[model samples]
Target chain A: MAETRTRGRAPTDPPASFVWTRRIVLTLLAVFTLVPVYAMVSSSLKPLEDVQGKFRWIPSEPTIRPYIDMWSTVPLARYFVNSVIVAGGATLASVVIAIGAAYAVSRYRFAGRRVFTVTVLSTQMFPGILFLLPLFLIFVNVGNATGLALYGSRGALILTYLTFSLPFSIWMLAGYFESIPRELDEAARVDGCGPVGALLRVIVPASLPGIVAVTVYAFMTAWGEVLFASVMTNDQTRTLAIGLQGYSTQHEVYWNQVMAASLVVSIPVVAGFLLLQRFLVAGLTAGSVK
Target chain B: MTSAKVSAAGAARAEGAAAAHGAGPGGSTGGRRRRRLPGKALPYLLLAPAVAAELIVHVVPIAVGIWMSFKELTLFYIREWSKAPGKGLGNYRVAVDVDGAIGADLLRSFLVTLAVTVLAVGLSWLLGTTAAVLMQERFRGRGPLRAIFLVPYALPVYTAVMTWAFMFQRDNGMVNHVLADQLHVTGGDRPFWLIGNNSFWALVTVIVWRSWPFAFLVLMAGLQNISRDLYEASALDGAGVWRQIRHITLPALRPINQVLVLVLFLWTFNDFNTPFVLFGKAAPAGGDLISVHIYHASFVTWNFGTGSAMSVLLLLFLLLVTAAYLLVTSRRRPAHG
Candidate 1:
């Protein structure tokens, strides 16, 4: 693609005038995309007074006070830790299990392959809200029957998030695994590897980009979850999704601190995404490599 | 690498010999191996954990939800939900009675959600597709622009929506500053965005901003698979940019778009967080999305039975739409997955 762009122009190329159009369109779209991001970042740096006043393109008096204040305001550290544990655990479990299931769906045909595929795909259509009440009931019932502590527990949150992440993980990783050549893994098997061995030795290395994409996706979904976190967690077990609401109280809302914490929490996920985004792009578009 | 390959070869022969001897003892494996059964048991073994998790997490909840819909479970009976009196679809009856208060509100919420979905999904797709097509061409600042577009998607949902809430603040938000002060579009009156009819547009804007990037990412990925030869061939035949896109790019992206549109619809329609966090306890009538309505119906009102019944209907409606969509789209072109 770089070569194509740098090479001589042809009739196949878009007209020279189209370049301006492209730039203008890209610029407009980029601005549109960055508006809220600008709001978040700019507001984060301002003090509460500045944020509550008229919107300023540039801060009148910039301070890191909000960043310092946010932790005390909300028990931000605890929420961050809880979010990391639950989202991380769910992502880890989902990705590992997804890899195996995806490899199976992609490589070997089984008796219930269609059933499994359809079931996973259709689960996407079920709204979390639709099942929220019943799922809460299930957690309550299971807790009652088996003496398991589910309510207001991080483990329960992890388990609940699985419903959201797993179906997509399996479906997406299956597509990724499908795009990979069967010959690579088959060669590993012929060279004295078991199914698991071939997967680790051959497929894993080959599809690292795809796997990275799935991992990032699963992590992000679990990270940003709000609905279940609100219901399933208490003050002790609250994730950032619900915990962020601590910025507001009966009479006051510290908008600056909220924005500061928002950026603070967003940085790691964003950095991770930006760093691995090349692989993510590669993974998503991996189909035509062969 | 060389030593590993050499050792692997040696191990293969050793393992082959071991397997031959073991085959006699493992009598069940011989018949399966002889016929090249395509690792029948192996696939199931790999799939077991995921399938089991899905059953417990997704499948069972759906069953329980269905069961909950039938019982007249309310605030009083929530503790003993299992033992709640069976209403035998009375909940369903109230939910569908469009002229009745409960049903009327639900119907209005559904319409609002449908409108939001149509506009948001359609705009998101268009913007995403356009950006994707433009980004295909390598240019100066392309990399930065691409990254910028994805920032919304990468941001946490709460943070993103909360930021939008700040932006939509009537008194001092960037939105009002731009429209009222900077641009003089609203006659310098800072209209209430988080309340009244404008809340609907606010909801759409935030949703579109967050979601379009997903469509962009997926569409861009799908665009990669379209062979450049097709584009070149069309260009040689005097096809302009629009024609080339319509004939080649859009058609080539059909399989991707089908799933993309459906997923986008589901996400937008069932979106609970955007409306919830954006509007505090209850959404304004104009912006009342069904997910929030159903949530309030059940948890807020403590009418579990009505909530479950409404949700069951939602599930069935979604299933019917999805099935119909698949059927229609597949009839036009074969399903990929």
Candidate 2:
């Protein structure tokens, strides 16, 4: 398309006269997109007084006092730890299991293959909220019945989050595996490698990008999720997602602290997205649809 | 490098073995290797974890929820070393038909969720699709501009909602201040946005603003996939921009738009964070969405039975809506099979 458009026309698609207008629009759009994030970061650095309604674009006197105050007043460090443990555990477990399952589905011509694939896709349709109470009840029962006390434990949060992450992991990884040529695995087998060896030595290495994408997605979804975290854990085992809920008291909510904490929590997610964004975007769009 | 040397030695050994075996093959016993059956239970072995976890975490809850809907139980009763005594249709009755407190709250919760979902999904779709199409045009600095558009999505919900709370503050909020200063408007002398029905609207606005970027991203990706030739051909045929979009772009975008709208509708309906942070206990009074109501029921009121029942009903509602969506969109396909 670009070649044809440039066949008889100038290099620039639009008239040269509109360049300045485009720049103005782009600047405005950039500012509009950035203002909230700027406010969040600046507000995190400001003292309570400077965060008031009359606050300007840049702080008159920047301070990290809010961060210090939040650290002292709240369980920020603990929430961070809890979030990391749950997200990391869930990601590792989901990705490993998803890789095996995805490889099996993509490469093997087993009976019930179509049914298995459809079941995986259909699980995405179930209402996530509906499972909350029943899950809570099950945890409560298991805690009591098994004497392990899953309720309000970090283990419970991890287990619950696994449910949400597994379906997508399987779906995306399956697509990624299917995109690889089966001949690679066949060639490995002819070189004295068995199916399992071929999978580990050849298939897994080939699908590293997809695995990274799934890992990042699982981590973000688990870390950022609130529902199961809120229901499954209490203050002690609470994740950052749940800990953010504390900004609200019975009567009033503390917006500054919440904003500060939210910004802190989002740092990893945004950084991860930006760093592996190329692979993540490629994997997601390629895997999600036909 | 180490593996290559090892393989070279191994290859020499294999060559000797092959020549030696060829001469001695007449004396060897013959055996045949059977083709490995595809359904050798290996697939199930690999699938065990995801399938088991889904069953335990997802499917079991659904099954247990269905059972709980037909029974009566409470935290107090459960702690007393007792079973959830069977009460056929009683929990459902209380959840759906009662007049006093639970039913009224449940009904109001459903209405709030519906309103928020419709407003959020509808408004975001409109804004996002427009932004996507407009932003698709070649323009300078467009790359940075596109990145900027994703800030709202990248910001954590807790912070966004908290910022919304500050912005909606009665006296000193930026939103109210701007309205009073620039627009010469006020909800009152000291407007408490979260105190009245205005709270609902304010929450919806924040949600729509934060969520449109998601829709926008999807639409932009979808739009970018469109073949430029289709648009160019339409333009060459003298169709107006709107006509070209209607005739060419819309048809190609229908599947993506349908899936997105449905998914967004479900998500917004179940969203609990904004309402919880913005209003706190005042959520039920101001109008709690179903998710908030379920949270309050289970945690605050400690009514597990009612909460489970509410959850089951909400799920049923979602299923019905999803079914309706499937029906409509399925029928929307071109008539011929």
List runs of model 2 lying over 4 Å from the truth: A1-32, A52-58, A247-256, B1-39, B80-82, B181-183, B238-243, B281-287, B335-337
Q: Which stretches of candidate 1 lie over 4 Å from their true place?
A: A1-13, A178-192, A286-290, B1-41, B332-337
What value does the lDDT take at residue A33 in candidate 1? 84
lDDT of 1 by residue, A11-81 (tens): 55666556667767877888888888888888888977888788898888889999998888879999999
DockQ of 1: 0.42
* Candidate 1 fraction of reference contacts recovered: 0.52
- Model 1's CAPRI class is acceptable
Cα lDDT listed for each candidate: 0.79, 0.68
Model 1: interface root-mean-square deviation in Å? 11.1
Give residue A244's error in model 1 in angstroms.
Answer: 0.5
Candidate that scores best on DockQ: 1
Cα lDDT for residue A169, model 1? 62
* lDDT of model 2, residue B160: 69
TM-score, per-candidate, Cα-based: 0.89, 0.86
